[model samples]
Target: MWRIDFFLDNGYENVSMNDIVKHAGGSLATLYKHFGNKEQLFIYILEQKSEEVFGEWGRKSVCYEGRIEEFLTETGRMFLDLVTTPDAILFHRLLISIGYINDSRLNKTQIQNLMSVPVIIIANYLENEKVNGHIEVEDTYLVAEQFLNAVKGPFLFQTILGIQIDISEETRLKALKQVVTIFCRGLHVIQ
Candidate 1:
């Protein structure tokens, strides 16, 4: 946790194991024993952050109960809330910059696993909706990805570009409803 805080305060490249040892109260040997190197440590931190953000959402047992729209609106809000935070924005920027420098550091499998957390959660919900006969989705995974991108793309783009867009609560709620309605319609949801 200290290492993560330090890295966030100072960019990843700027921090060294010695620096972490100085502040984190661990010996160099112990640090190396836990994490092989800086890249590994950074990846570990990212995995931890991913789990913190998506773990509960991914693990919760839920059924739509014929309230798919309501579920989508609430999930969309949660997704937006998670992505729009200052820390999340900064972390995403850091990851992108790092990816450009050394793409291999962000291993494909690791990235897929991290990115799949939310998708898997939403896919499970969609599958439940399908089984309950509330919607017709030929591909739950693709639909989940599309729905997330639709709800999160515009705001995320603005955020990534450092643009400040003030959206009122009412406007945000209306937009979420519109997205959910359109998505459900696409799924051929009845009522």
Candidate 2:
């Protein structure tokens, strides 16, 4: 999987199956048996990468039980940081290009499942807070969405539409912290 990322990051797009197999020191027959074709191989690599990325977040969220607002603010910044990395941004651009090329194979539900990791984590944190009387959320999902929207403007624009705005680390952290603080204030029980 790392080999695939390396090749793709190194500008090997639109290459043939033969090239991939040769580059990876494997045979055509083995490549065909394992991945079928170039598209399949690329999607397979993406699937593997998505799982590795989202799975790590899931694992950390499971063990997390800190202040819900602070936790979400930090986690949101981390998520944006991951998405903004060069390799990650390139992966998204490749997917968008593929989607534009009449190939919806990359949009399979299984692959799409990887994207819901943050939503799940935020919902979990909000629900936990509600349960513990730390905050009040009538609808966890919607609150999660609102919280996301608050910290979403910069990275979401860049990821979805190639908006080339530079977001500094300090600015990103401040934005996330403000969103979480606002969310907490909005939903907290005032005495």
Q: Pick the candidate with the highest lDDT.
A: 1
lDDT of 1 by residue, 71-125 (tens): 7887888887887777777767766666667634546577667867888888888
Residue pairs clashing in model 2 are none
* Model 2 Cα lDDT, one tens digit per residue, 1-191: 32556544554356667677666776889888987766677667766776776667666764556466557866788777887677767766655565576644444564455555567777887687677677766998788767776777667656657676767788788778777777778887433
lDDT at 83 for candidate 2?
70
Report how far off residue 175 is in candidate 2 (Å): 1.3
Model 2 vs. true fold: TM: 0.76
Task: Report how far off residue 73 is in candidate 2 (Å).
Answer: 1.9
> Which segments of candidate 2 are over 4 A away from where they belong?
1-13, 37-40, 159-164, 189-191
> Stretches of candidate 1 above 4 Å error?
61-63
lDDT of 2 at 105: 46
